[model samples]
Target: MPIIIQPAEASHVLPITELVNLFAAENLMLPRTEESVRQTLADWLVAVDPDAQPDDPPILACGALVPLTETLVELRSLAVHPSQQGKGLGGHMVNHLVQMARERGYHQICALTLREQFFVRLGFEPVDRWSISPKVWQACIYCPKFHRCDEVAVIMNLVENPQAAVHPLARPAGWNTLLKWSEWQPLRLAYKQKQAQVQ
Candidate 1:
């Protein structure tokens, strides 16, 4: 069966939410409201199986790229159907989104993910989450487990020139930002515990 990769339509919104919420239920991601999906519908890209019968779901996978700054975008809400995992559809969707970001004049794209190796294989390198925009953290602050986050931050540079690939973070997050520092402490402790367990 052939799958089509394209901009999400109004029809795709519900399926995309359904697919993403399935993972969100497993604590793999933050649950999205239908209204949130509707609001950011334009930012979303969906992979659909157009030839499906009446019983089939219209979407197989979906992801969104949200701009944090003119040169940077945060890749979020990426989800693949459970039946569709390990089929390379996730990578294909990411590549398509990267191209779309480049076309739109973005210099870098970033994601906070537990699937670190997957994004690494797709040309993203590890970066400090604080290196991303506070707008990114603004969304995280709403997450229920913000105090014990398990996600890793990864980024990909889109410049054709190697030297231009380095993206300078807008403002470094530090002690001066009292609220962010307070929020990060628990996650820091959780990471330390994980590290201790591995030792």
Candidate 2:
């Protein structure tokens, strides 16, 4: 099926929620409520047959680019309809969002994903989950599985100068103030808690 990648519109909310929650039901990804979807609908991208009529596109796949901090964004809630699986639609949506992030001046994009290899194949490198800023945990704190979260963090640099765009959570010279450390400390705790549970 021919599909186009485009920014999601207001009318796309219900289908996007349904698609995301389909995977959520199977423990594949985080579930999204209509309110949550509505709140961030502007950041979402939809894969649909462009020939379809106005206001009711059949959203074959969907995802969102959620800004986590000034220089970092998280790709969350990526989903593709089961019938459209393995057709490279999910990858297309991801690349589209990555470009959007680049254009918007984000230095890095990351995702907490169970499908680490899939993102890896798309040029993302796996990183320590704790190595990400705790801002990534805002939505996570609301999650029922927060105490036992099990998602791998993967990141890709959007800048042409990768070295210049250091991962936001990396500690650097003179940056050891309490405020900075406190801001990033939570993910380390979350990571260790998950690690201890495994052992």
Most accurate candidate by TM-score:
1
Badly placed stretches (over 4 Å) of model 1 are 160-199
Cα RMSD, each candidate: 9.2, 7.2
Q: Given candidate 2, what's the lDDT at residue 57?
A: 42
Inter-residue clash pairs, candidate 2: none
Give the 10-residue window scoring lowest on summed lDDT in candidate 1.
174-183
Please give the lDDT score at residue 159 for candidate 1.
76
34-79 in candidate 2: lDDT tens per residue? Answer: 9988998889999988676665447889999988667778999999
Query: In model 2, which runs have C-alpha deviations exceeding 4 angstroms?
Result: 51-57, 162-183, 187-199
Error of 2 at 35 (Å): 2.1
Encode model 1's per-residue lDDT on 56-142: one tens digit a residue. 877899999888766778899999987788999999999999998988888778899999999999998877776565556656765
**Could you tell me the lDDT of residue 83 within candidate 2?**
77
Q: Which ten residues in a row have the lowest lDDT in candidate 2?
A: 174-183
Q: How far out, in Å, is residue 190 in model 1?
A: 21
